[model samples]
Target chain A: MDHRQEDQFEYQLKSALHRQEPPNGFTVRVLARLEPARPEPWPQPWLHLPSLRWALACALGIAVFAGGWMFQQERRRAEGEAARQQVMLALRITGAKMQLAEARVRHLSER
Target chain B: MKRTLLSVSIVVAAAICAPAQTIKVPESWDKLAAKADDVVNVSLDKKMLQFASKFMEEDENEKHLVSKLNGIYVHSLEFKNEGEFTESDVDPIRTQLQGPEWIHIVDVHNKTERENVVIYLKMVNNQSLGMAILVEEPKELTFVHLDGPISPGDLSDLSGSFGIPKNLHVSEKETSKPKAEIKK
Candidate 1:
């Protein structure tokens, strides 16, 4: 095409794509679209009460402590019983040997 | 400095003054244990006796005797064959009882049956400190040491209750028999 025709086409394109004012509330609409909607926090009404929270924590602590104490007590009792059996056996042996010694003396003296 | 010195002196004195109650078993005895068919070893110190006494509910006499004892040690070995151990194995135990404080209370040897039983009592100022019994049979050897203030009379009462031979129930009269040989 000739230079005159090219210049006419360029003027038409510029007028057609000229900058203009944005529609009203365009910024607010874009911001709202980009931003995330915040959800509500989990409902913990019991945790919000200080006394109930403290009570639950204390009960858990006490259960753990009492279980440990009972285990220790049972262990000690078992050990004590074993030791008792040994003591009895020792005494029984001593007594039996003493009896034999005494019997020997008695038998010899009768002769 | 003076307080520390006093404390040290008191501890040293207590250590020296404490009666030697526990009999030292010879390490050589371990060799016999390896050959034995059955072994019975019981070693209970003062703390163990105290702990065990709490559970001695079956018999009051046992509870009383156990409470008074500081320690009890027994080592018995049974052999499958005759003469698995010799007199030399027992000499170490006998030597320990030969200390000045220990008095040989009973020594009965049956030559015919090849059985020997010896009893020794540790006495200090007429107070019984402890007792030791050594019994040797054809296939078994038993050694018993009872620490604390216990006399033969205390053990005599224990018979017939704790699986001890019922015949061991010696009355005071029988225990005092002239032939029974009660050494003061």
Candidate 2:
């Protein structure tokens, strides 16, 4: 009813509304359950068998040698064919020119 | 003995007689080149000239006028000699015909006779405005220029008489703009 009593009542109501309950042993429960994680075991060393290494090396060598040989063979074959073609072409050209020259000469002689 | 000796001498003489002269065969292109100097210049080939003239004489109204189309010109050709014709032989004519007003679009090589066949097309926009071909054969030379809406496919059709090389490519214009014209 009085100003002081009304002020006290309002303060008490605000305090009651804002008050919070204490947590139920949450920190203790979490600490009790917690345990440090174990570090994973190191991976096993890669297999390095002598036979496997040798087999791999042999395969690579064989592949390289085969590729190189094939390339060389192809190049030589191409060159040989080109040379043969050139010779044939030249012979053909020369023969035609001679024939033409002969015709021209014959015509000139007749005139 | 004297008779036998005479017979032997005659046989030997006959055997020593020179073999008949073998006429060497020349290749088709080589035979063609040997007569190049006598071949008519590209400016004089009657058939090609007629075709070019016909193209130019088309009615202006009937002509397909694309903003990208340009002028057309043609040349008659004959080659009459066997020497290797260089790019220089064709350069003078190309220079005269090509300028700010004209563009160079194609250069094709005829391998059989080692001849350079040059084609110049006039350009407007990015399209072929006109077209021309300079075919230097072993025994003939022909130049053709066409002015109109010419397509690159039309050139493929025109190249039937002469063998077109597989490596033929259309030269690109220097400018990035579509309106840029290609120069020789």
Name the candidate that leads on lDDT.
Answer: 1
Per-residue error (Å), model 1, residue A91: 1.2
TM-score of the first chain of model 2? 0.48
Of the true interface contacts, each candidate retains a share of 0.67, 0.00
Q: Relative to the unseen true structure, what is the C-alpha lDDT of residue B137 in candidate 2, on a scale of 0 to 100?
A: 54
Worst 10 residues of 1 chain B by lDDT: B1-10
lDDT of 2 by residue, A4-91 (tens): 9999999999998996856999877777776455455554234267777778789999999999999998875554443333222222
Per-residue C-alpha lDDT of model 2 across residues B52-128, encoded as one tens digit per residue: 23343322322222122232222222343444455555666666555554554434443544555444555566665
lDDT of 1 by residue, A1-111 (tens): 899999999999999999987999999988897677645556577688999889989999999999999999998888777777777677767767777887786677688
Residue-wise C-alpha lDDT for candidate 1, range B18-118, written one tens digit per residue: 52447877876788888877777777777677778999887787888888888787777877899888888899888888777787667788987778988
- By summed lDDT, the worst window of 10 consecutive residues in model 1 chain A runs over A37-46
On TM-score, the candidate that comes out on top is 1
Every model's DockQ? 0.30, 0.00
